[model samples]
Target chain A: MATLELRGVRKTYGTGEVVKGVDLSIKDREFVVFVGPSGCGKSTLLRMIAGLEEISAGELLIDGVRANEIPPDERELAMVFQSYALYPHMTVAGNMGFALKMAGKPKAEIAAKVAQAARILQLEALLDRRPKMLSGGQRQRVAIGRAIVRNPKCFLFDEPLSNLDAALRVQMRTEIAKLHQELEATMVYVTHDQVEAMTMADRIVVLNGGRVEQVGAPLELYRNPASKFVAGFIGSPRMNMLEVAVAGHDGAAVRLTLPGGESLAVPARDALVKTGARVTLGLRPESLNLADDGALRGKVEVVEHLGAEMLVHVRTPQDDLLIIKAPDEARIHPNQTVGIGINPARSCLFGEDGLALILRVDALA
Target chain B: MAGGTKVGGRREGRGWPLLSPAVIVLGIWSVVPLAMTLWYSTRYYNLLDPGRHFFVGLRNYDLLFSDPGSLTAIANSIILVASVLVISLIVGTALALLLNAEFPGRGAARLFAISPFFVMPPVAALIWKNLLLNPLNGLLGWMMGLFGLPVIPWFSTAPMVALIIIVSWEWIPFATLILLTALQSLDSSQIEAARMDGAGPLARLRYIILPHLGRPVAIVVMMETIFLLSIFAEILTTTSGGPGDATTTLTFLVYIRALLDFNVGGASAAGVLAIVLANIVGLFLMRSVARSLNR
Candidate 1:
């Protein structure tokens, strides 16, 4: 096991900077995922860490040693590319044993190691077949087997499951999680899918436009996002954001007028909020419930009947759209008026600067 | 229903009528000449004595097999094609790898490297014969003089070697162009994976790049063999099968017999022999090299 640290790592292509001063410390045996939208510099950062791309300006430390000038092979890291990158000409066993052969290991030793890795990946039957002869899932296992034979200090996955179909991606996702548990190696994975990040990552680093937006545990990022960007990004169906104007602030809480002219009290200190100031109110879909005596009113525009739950799209009188998660059996229909109830404790408040304001303890309770 | 069936039969008959133009052109261009050649090869025909012709079954073939010059021509043809293929493939692979790397002026350099392939065969032969390898005052002779070395006569002394060098120079660009295109299509991530697997440059080249290039290289060999067997203009323009028939290949021998000696029967027999040889080589290459690639 090894700890990986990136100190102010930067990458620039010609004049355009792609990865801007990303600083992170990954602990031993930790599964850290870099998650973001397309062109968010998450892949670039991962490549830099893999030594596939040069580190433009900062130090990459592996086990407290600077490894900026180290070649990828010498860096003691194995990367699983999205394309799988298996040697098409060689058999599965040959591909797995290639590194050992290149390092001048004896034939018997290489074969033994390859056999062990095949046993681990359940690829013993495929050892004699070439990559072109294998299915997509088998090729993926061969790719992992190739990495397993190396026994590197850390494993880097560059969106490894992006090419698989939906069902297979889910199956392989669990398999990878199990592999991590078995190997217990420090793994760094990059993907644009937040669900993968939420499901597989021990800690998730959310990136946007060449910069890290927030880095925290998946649930921590889901529960307490640092900015409006993260709040909208971390959760499925997206967190509903409504523009609000502060009506007034009491000594312990701030009273805000929603877009539909309804007022609610949010637990925010007076110093962090001001009277007549504008802010965005963040609420997850699950945080909003349907109540008979709720104050806020909206018309249901659409109803999505998922098997386990129902997603109700509501349009308020202020013309703002909000999604509410309801039970599958909930009787919701389009063109019907409904009340949306918000729990103040599960809500977040973003100031004019887009930074999350401190929520008072009473509201969190 | 009878009228409709008649009309459909008429329409079906129209297909051959429409296709007759291409068929007629191919018959005149290919089949008629081949038939004429086949007829002439079985007879004793001489352009110099057209009225004294007679059928001579297998006599011309027997004469060709018995002629010592025919054996030399066959050997020279095999040597020329094999040497050029070997030299071009090796140099072309190296040049393709060099051009594949990231460097300034790479585009212009690639264009320059492939420029020789576009040069006319006769023009390339003449340029090498007169300006490059002429023993008296050629550039190579001048370089030899500068080094105080003997300025040996290239074409006169080493005609086969000179022919091989000139042909390889012209054909290397073709091999390089095809191989370079194949090299460019290689997935970069595969190379990166190999590198991450602790493969150095040599190992990567051996295990990845060469294997990826297998099909294209086979194609290059097949195409080059087809063209290399019929190499005529260069031999005609430069050596002319001189120096005691040292550089006389099968096609050159055919030209000498048909055009110079006017021996129609003998030339036709040799032409048929060349076709048989080419087909045998082509079949072997397809079965051995191309099939192994499985492209």
Candidate 2:
């Protein structure tokens, strides 16, 4: 296993730069997931690290050796493409053992390695079948097995599970996580699905607009998003954000106002508040509740029952909609005026520039 | 509504009236002549003299079997088709691979490559014969004089070689065009995946591209075989089976017997033999290739 590093790596196609000045270090045996929205340069960065794309500027290092000039074959990295680009004519055994055969490995060793990988992937019965005979999930296994036979310095997965069905994707996700642990090889995976990154990554690098927005564990990003974008991206059903203005401040508690004569005295940031500063208040769906002693009242627009919980899309007097997960099967009617409980402690406040306003523990206590 | 209906399921198998236009055209254009040929194959019938009739049935067929000229014609036909098809396939597939590669002015190069197929066969034959391989005045002689190399009598020393060259030149563009289109449509991602699997250039070609080209190569071979088997005009214009029957093929032999020798019975017999030979070859080939394609 080798430590891979990218120092201000850049890539441009014709005119517009696809991967712009990226710097990252992947430690040995570390599983790093590059998570982003589409066109955020995650796959391009992974390809650059694998030496598939030419680095326009800066350098790439593998095990302290500058590898910018090395070709992909010489780089000793295997990539599982999003399409599971298996050789159509080759059998499962042929697809997996092709690399070793290319490398001039001994016949016995090639056979042994193929058998081992097939056993790991439960592909013993499928060894003689061609790719056309295999299902999508089986083809994905073959694609992964093809990568496994190389035993390269690192394994790069470009959304390897995207083509499988939902159930297969989850199964293969777990299989890949187990494979990483079993191999203990350096891996860099790129996916637009943050759930994949959140579930599988040791450290998820959240990227947006070709820049790394935040790098942390899944729960760390969920609990303390560095910016509003990360806040919206990291959580399921997405965090709700609404524009708000500072009404006034009262020591640790501050008064905020919405449109149409709406006001509430919620908690304040440790930093000094400006009266005219434009900010967005973010609330997770599970953060609010409906109770008799509630602080904010809104008309229930849509009520969705999920057996275990209910989601009420509540419309405030200012016409801002908030989705709250009522922890029980609350049979609420739509168009009925309902009051919502508030927890300022669970809500996040962002400045006009979308930077997180770090909160203190003493104020919540 | 009653007239517009398709009638009964019992009338399903009796749909020939619905197909009568096509059947009538085919009968007029194809079946009638084939039946005439079959009838003529069994008689001494001539279009020039309808009354000079005799039932000299097996005589013409026996004469064809015994005649060394007719046998040599059949052999030459087989040799020409086999040689030309192999040559065109290799040359065409190589051209396709080269055209598939990314290069400067590749579009113009491809246009130049496929232009020869569009050249009318007779015109193409004339160009190769009178303008290209002509012993004295052609470009080959001119180039030979410029390079101080001995000018070769292309038609005399190697008659079949001349025919092979002419056929390949005419049909190579077509074969190359087919193979090139197939190569262009190949998914680049699959090849990239192979490359990442540590396959070098030769391995990629042998294991990946060749397998992908299998069905297309089969198609080129099948289509080219049918055309090459009856290559008549090129030989007719160039050698005309001259210099003691050195390049006489089956079609040329039939033409000589019917048009030159005026033996319509012998020619009809030879034509039947030619059809049988072609069917044997085609059936032998279709068995293998149809495994990869629809009949």
Candidate 3:
């Protein structure tokens, strides 16, 4: 078992700092995914953990021991790169056993370990095939098999499924999640896809502009985001944001005025907001429903049918574009005037500083 | 005919008119000289006895096979090419690896390293014979004397070795440049993966870098073999076929027969022999290069 802890770990290239003072602790056998946009330093943080990039300052501890000076091989971590990076000249078996051979393992032992990893990765039939001879999916499996043969303390994956087709990406995602369970080793994964982060991670760390926006379970971040960035990033089709003015405080909720003079009272802590102050209203597409006599009035702009569910884009009277998810049976058409309904308890309110006001949810109670 | 073949044939038909000018020019340039050489090889022609020319089919071949000096020249040709090819490849690979790294003045250093290839062969051989390899006052001899080493006269004592050295010096830059370009194309991620796999510097070179360089090295070998087979200027300037026949390659032997002895028939026969030898070597090298490229 291995526990990775990063205390104020930073990476700077010349005058610019890419990973600016990150503090995190990954528990043993836990799968932590670092998810962010491009240039958010998620991959840079993974490289620093793998000892591929030098940590500019601060300390990295592996299993409670300071491992700042440790080399990558000595750190007992294996990485699966996005490009696979398999040795083109060597066969699958040779690629898997190279690390064991470098560590002076005997021939029989290396062969046995390579065989086991190939069996686990289902690469036994491809043992003699070079990397160029393998398909993209098979090459990805061999890259993972090479990492598995080493039996390192932790596994780091850097956007391993980005090069795959959509179907293959889903298939490999499940396979990687299964592999993590079977190995029960600490893993640090980096991806820009929020769905991959939500589905595969035990804990997800959302980064923006080289800093952690929030860190929590998938549903926890979904139900109660600590900032506007997390709320907008963690869902598909993106949460529809509208500017509003705080009307008043109502017990545990904040009453707000929408753009079209309609009001919304969202269930959140009222201490961080003042009346008549402008704040952003975040409504998930799934939380918004189409109704005949609903509160918010708008014209249906576009209707997208997905067999089971339909996403209807509406332009409100205030010219704000909003997406509402409806059932397939809802007869919605473009340019049709319709009223939209929002779930107050599921909605979120953000102050002017882009920080989400805390939500008082039933799950927390 | 198949539709695909018909389409391909039409495309080639259209391309031929555009390509015929170059093709015809090259055909005449190579075929005319070869025809003349073949025709002259079968005749008994001499500049000294110009009026006594006649058909002497295979007589020049018989005499060339019987001559001891001609056989020694053949052996020396093989020795010079083989030795120079080996030395240049090994030293070139080492220098390419060294120059691939980051260092101060690396741009300038690479410029200096590759500048030797720009020097004309005759000029380079002159510099080596006078300023470097000369026994009396050359830089190499003076350095050897400072280190308390015995200095032997290079051209007079070991002409074949001296010729090999000069040729290797000229060819090493070509090898290094080709291999360096191939080295740059190697994926940096592959090296990092090997590093993370616990391979040290030498292990990475043997297992990763060298295999990556295999195809390019084969190309270097094939190109160098073709050019090295006809090496003439360096030999003409440095040792001029040696104190005896020690450094006379087949190309030099041809020059000696036609110019020094004025026997056009003998020189043509030697030229034919050189062509046959070069073709054999080229065939093997091309096959090996194709194999490596396919790999």
Candidate 4:
């Protein structure tokens, strides 16, 4: 029954503010991921929640109680660091049992708890071996086993899988997801990998420059991003944004001229856009198709053929480079001139401030 | 087999030539003196009457083993080394932990903590004897006078303790610097993990910090033991084996036998014993280091 609430929480180091007024609520047993690029203050926010970093301002509540001044040990939170952070001198069982021993648990209780955690982590056979004798994945499991033995209220993971190889990372990702189900504990994970957030999170909070850009389910963020930054960041093979001039507005829909002088209309009933005002148009690569009467014309510059699909890099008439996902069997060649069609209903329009313009369904049709 | 033999032959041919100069220098510097000492230990050699020397076999060694002064010297040597090792290791670890914490003036504090290591042994002994612990006009004497306590003559009454204090002061910096470096190399994330695991300060030190420092502490002990086994300069400068050989360590006793009494054979036998003792300790230290490395 652990829940976390942050009210205008901030972290300032000297004159530079790293986490600026992050207000969030994490539900009980929810796996919430803080996803962002490097230096986006995601780790700092997690550290603050872990009570490892001091909150420069505002409040943090755990289970409906004010916990800003509490030390990490008393806060009942466990963090798995990227480096695993296992004690090299101790055996796996010892490392897992240290916290319980420190809390004055009897030797039998500590050993029993450690044995249970080792069994859960499939580390029973390795309990007597020191950390240096374990492989990277084994060490990581020991770190998690150490955390599990404590049975904290919340689990915080700071890029825990970033140190593993690509194959190991995917394996550990599934392991972590399964662990979340087994424990049913509230977990706050921080990572720069969008795919990890997309696959593992119940909800992902996207941050940029120490501010929360958007928060939603993975597909919701992928389908309907709230900002141009989110639209570009949340999706693989990122959405291409082109600068366009507003042709006119018909009170219900706004019309814009593309870079190649092709005009398109988008639903923007709530957008305060003026005629002749320059705005940005966002088009996902998958939303594009090859049509005989397509308005946008471009020459294919490069072709990357994956097993199921091909990424077509196109140069438009306006010299803008764009990516188009084509069917794998479609034998496209470089320097081939083609007409690329954009689906306006599946597109997005951003104002000069990079804020997404709310779209009405009828106008989208 | 051919490939292995070729590689081995090439390595032997190239390595031996490259190592020739070092081997030659070591042979001249160490082996020659050792051979001379071995020869001298077997005869009644004396600088005072070189022409009257005779074959003594193990007589010098027997004399050394039976001498009450040599026994006192051996005991004093063990006491000094053991006391200095204990004091420096405890104080050094504490200082390292203190310096590892973030605080104002930490850089300057570390500089001061490591300054004594740079002081030469004789100079350090002199500074302690004259400026810090002297019975008449030293700072400690003045402090005792202010408290209405009698000034205790350190070298006269507590010569071994005085020597231990002086040696520990000089060696503590060496231990502190090594331990501090080990402390710095400790993964901060591990400490943070310990905190998150419900361990407080003392728990973290007991379970994490001390265990992590094991290898570095072993190294410090090994190095300090090697140097402390033959500590001569401090005693020569300050206590000079004291009022009744209270602080006459093995090295000082050998110096007295060879230079003062001109009993070269006796001194050489003592030197041979010191070498054997040092080797036993070195073997133990090497085994510990090797075990840690394997771990």
- lDDT per residue, candidate 3, A259-293, as tens digits? 87878777765457888998888888988998776
Is candidate 2 or 3 superior in lDDT? 3
Q: For candidate 4, give the docking quality class from DockQ.
A: high
Q: Report the C-alpha lDDT of model 2 over B155-230, residue by residue, as the tens digit.
A: 8898888888998898888789888988987888788887777778888889988888888888888888888888
DockQ (CA atoms), all models = 0.82, 0.69, 0.75, 0.83
Residue-level lDDT of model 3, residues B161-269, one tens digit each, is 8889999999999999998898889888888888899998999999999999999899899999889989999999988897888889999999999999999999999
Best by DockQ: 4
* Candidate 1 lDDT score at position A334: 95
Per-candidate Cα lDDT values, in order, are 0.92, 0.85, 0.91, 0.90
User: Over the stretch A1-365, how does candidate 4's per-residue lDDT look in tens digits?
Assistant: 49999999999999999999998999999999999999999999999999999999989999989999999989988889999999878889988998888788999999999999988899999999989889999999999998899998999999999989999999999999999999999999999999999999999999999999998888778877889999999888999888999999886678899888889887666567888999888888997886657878899899889979988889987988889887876668898998988887777888888998754344313
Native-referenced DockQ of model 3: 0.75
User: What stretches of model 3 exceed 4 Å from their correct place?
Assistant: A361-365, B1-23
The digit string of per-residue lDDT tens for model 2 on A288-361 reads 89875576788998888888888899898878888988866655899988877767766777887888875645
Of the true interface contacts, the fraction found in model 4 is 0.92
TM-score of chain B of each: 0.92, 0.91, 0.94, 0.94
Model 4 chain A: worst 10 consecutive residues (lDDT sum): A356-365
Q: What 10-residue stretch in candidate 3 chain B is worst by lDDT?
A: B69-78
Clashing pairs in 1: none
Comparison by DockQ, 1 against 2, better one: 1
Per-model TM values vs. the true structure: 0.95, 0.93, 0.96, 0.96
- Score candidate 4 by DockQ: 0.83
